[model samples]
Target: MAEKFSGKKFSGKTVYSGITMGKVLILRKDPQIRRVKIADPEAEKERVYGAVDRAKQQLAALYEKAVKEVGESSAAIFEVHQMMLEDDDYLDAICHMIQTEMINAEYAVSVTGDNFAGMFAGMEDEYMQARAADVRDISVRLVRNLSGQEEVDFSAMEPSVIVADDLSPSETVQMDKKRILAFVTVHGSTNSHTAILARMMNIPALIGVPMDLSEIRTGMTAIVDGAAGEVIFEPTEFQCSEAERKIKGEQEKLRLLQELKGKRNETRDGRTIQIYANIGSVSDVGYVLENDAGGIGLFRSEFLYLGRDDFPSEEEQFQAYKQVVQTMGQKKVIIRTLDIGADKQADYFDLGKEENPALGYRAIRICLKQPEIFRTQIRALLRAAAYGNLSVMYPMVISVEEVKQIYAFVEEVEQELKQAQIPYRIPEQGIMIETPAAVMISDELAELVDFFSIGTNDLTQYTLAIDRQNQKLEDFYDPHHKAILRMIRMVVENAHKCGKWAGICGELGADLELTREFLDLGVDELSVAPPMVLKVREKVRGI
Candidate 1:
């Protein structure tokens, strides 16, 4: 007879969203390495180099596969892994140990890996610390290849939620992602590559679970509530049935929403609302269409600037913008120019250390200081405008004088484009009302732009004098403060008075409770995440 096990629940952080029920598949830990004396150091060194070559070839193949499985952006990590494998520091450490210590190739690579990983692990920055995993991953692959150890065959397993102490980016990519229903890591950060892969795979994932693995058994049924960051195990039949019911209900809701795709974005009162999606990259256009967004309210152009050694050229930017504009056809696409700096950093920008980056030079401030860079982006946007409906939006706009200066620069770019005989159009221009200064002078600022999009997230942070990044002050950070609502009302009213439409593209836009309030205040649109598009549309229909 099957032994009856007690039911247990574990709480953790959600890295992605979905509810899934499956059997447990515990990922085995890395095998232990035994140090052995080498009779031939020269031979060990040759073997180590050979392993590197093999690892490189394997990673290259994996990179191509990842590109097809996920997108190029997510797959780029494999390219980075290839570079890490060939890094002089890493190679030199392994070769030095093999030549000097007469150690086996596997032992030398293992020591070198630990040394390099420790260096990164000791870094003060969390992002840099997370990079240590990459070092360890490459080293392990090299060691495995040299030792002739077989890789884990996830394809042989039935569909299940993968439970692990941790998973490196490489491991996550190399695994048979198709068989994995979800992932639950006992040790991992929300910013880790595991989390990124989970998101790219569009599967539910939970991380930072405080669970004792000894208590977990393979083939044990488990329920993962990814949104709530909870995992239930060995639930009663009643509980399992209830969870299945909820899952079906959610699926039904989504099915109904899918039916509403391409439907008119009209409220119950017959008022039209421009429902749009905010995307961070060109690849997100697929989801935008899937959700039937009226248009793209914000296309964060910073992705091109980040994770690179140099600034993106005008041609590079143009091709990207053109692809998106052409794909969207006549649908409006508003590209928000380079909101880098602050939390989002680029080494090439040389945006020196700032005691208060959030309040200091960032976004438009950096762009304005570097006119050549700004002109490059403007030229790209203008050239792309020829293809389809594309509008440009400036972030962190604070004054009428700043608006005037921006116009002056735009005129220069227009003249340059004309002289070059470039075919383009003067698409609609707008500014993000995210600062208190902008909100206070919104009436004057309204007359300077074609429209207004209230960035309620930053406005609330700046107005409340609360640091949104600080978890300790989360309770005090109120997006619903009367001050924020009044500012939104002010921006919307001023926009109307100036013969312009007003929309919100912040987190507050997805707040269903605030939908009627915003509509009542004359807001014309709500731009939200792709997942919230249908929900917001449903709310709009209700109103």
Candidate 2:
């Protein structure tokens, strides 16, 4: 009977949304690695190096395939994998172990992988913890190659929802996307690479699921609701039909929203508003265009700073900004300067622990203190401005004086570019009204900047005096509170009074319930995630 289990349900975080009804396909947690004695140590070393080359080639193939399937931005992770293989830290550890311990190549690689993976897994950051999977993935590949064993083949199975401890980018790319209905993992976060791939595939996925794998078996019927982050084992026929109906209903709703593409974003009362996307990487440009976003309202440049050992070079930063600007074409791209500190930390930045990182030594404060770093970013943004419709926005601005200081640095960068005879345009500059202080002095700050983008996430966090990251305080982190609405209205009025425009690029911007309220407040733009763009656009058209 395949150990039929029904009515068993578990909850998790939804990384992507959809309804999936399919048989369970549970993958083995990890391939069993065996240790064997080798005749020659030198031969073992060569074997390890050979495995590295083969792995590199495999990742390169996956990279090209991913770029074609997804976008260049999303496929960039494979490039990271190739780098991981080439990373001296990882490679050296394996080589050192083989030479010093006189162990076989496969054993040395496995040991080193465990050490490195453990170090990363022990890190407090979720992103770093995910990197541990990469180490294990490469190690498995090397071992499999050394042993002349073929990787697991799931091609023969019928289409089903994949259940696993976790999945890597390499594994994800190799899967038959058409055969896999969705992904349910026992471990991973919404930001994990597996979750990101699910979103890219536009399929339902539930990560960090709490379930007993022993109770799950192949051929058992299952229902995965990504939005609710719930999985039902051995669902009844009626339950499956109901889920299928809901899935079709949601798909139809999305289709209707897609019909609104190319249509002007206008309210029922003849009011026009701009709908844009808040993107973090160049790959996100595809989503922006797909949703017919008016522009890239907030390009979170912090992504360029993370996942590396040191600060990104000026040219590296420039190329990234230029790629985004050129792709957006006539549509404006508002690039927010590196907003680090708080939760977004870099070891290179050496931002020491603070009692309150959110309020201390972050964003504009860090930039103002490190003008050289700020200048490097500004120079890149300024130079890229000549290439496309690019603008600049600063985060965590609290006072008019801080805005003035930013402008002063902008002038310095502009003069240096002029001295070099570099072709650049003075991009339209603005600041994020995230702090309560910024709202109180919006009237003064509004006169200085070209526009205002209310970052409601931080605004609500600071207003409610709650740490949004803390689960205990989640109930207190109300985004639709009256105080936040009032602050947004005040900023909009201040911007309008100064003949400037105000837009929102935060979680609240995607709230359909607040769409009419924002329009009523005279907010000029709503920038949200790419998937929410059409939905927000539909809301605007209906209002």
Query: 370 in model 2: Cα distance from truth in Å?
Result: 2.5
Report the lDDT tens digits of candidate 1 across residue range 1-543.
114454578998887778888899876556467788888888888898899898888888888987775446557777999999878888888888888887788888888888888999998765677678778888888888888874555557788888989885546656776788889989877645576556545578998898877678778888988878888878778879977987898799888888787778778779878989888667778888878888899888987776544688888789889989989999999999999887777666777779998899899998899998899999999999999999999999999999899999999999999998998888999999999999899999988899888888788889999986565896887778999999899999899998999899987998888988988898988888777788888888877
Model 1 segments more than 4 A misplaced: 1-8, 13-17, 23-47, 63-93, 104-107, 113-137, 140-222, 233-239
lDDT of 2 by residue, 1-543 (tens): 344565678998787778878888887545566676666778888898898898888778778887775446557777887888898988888888777777788788889999999999999876677679778878877887777764556557688899988875546656777788999998866555576557545689998788888778877888999878799998777778888998899889988988988999897889999988888767768878887889999998987786444677788789889999999899899999989998777666878779988888989899999988898999999999999999999999998888889898899888999999998999999899999999999999988999999998889889999876565786666778999999999999999999999999987898889999998999998888788888888888887
Candidate 1: C-alpha lDDT? 0.83
* C-alpha-based local distance difference test score of model 2: 0.84
Cα displacement (angstroms), candidate 2, residue 138, comes to 5.1
Model 1, residue 179: displacement in angstroms?
7.3
Worst 10 residues of 2 by lDDT: 191-200
Cα miss at 73, model 2 (Å)? 13
Whole-model Cα lDDT of every candidate shown, in order: 0.83, 0.84
TM-score of predicted model 2?
0.80
The candidate scoring highest on TM-score is 1
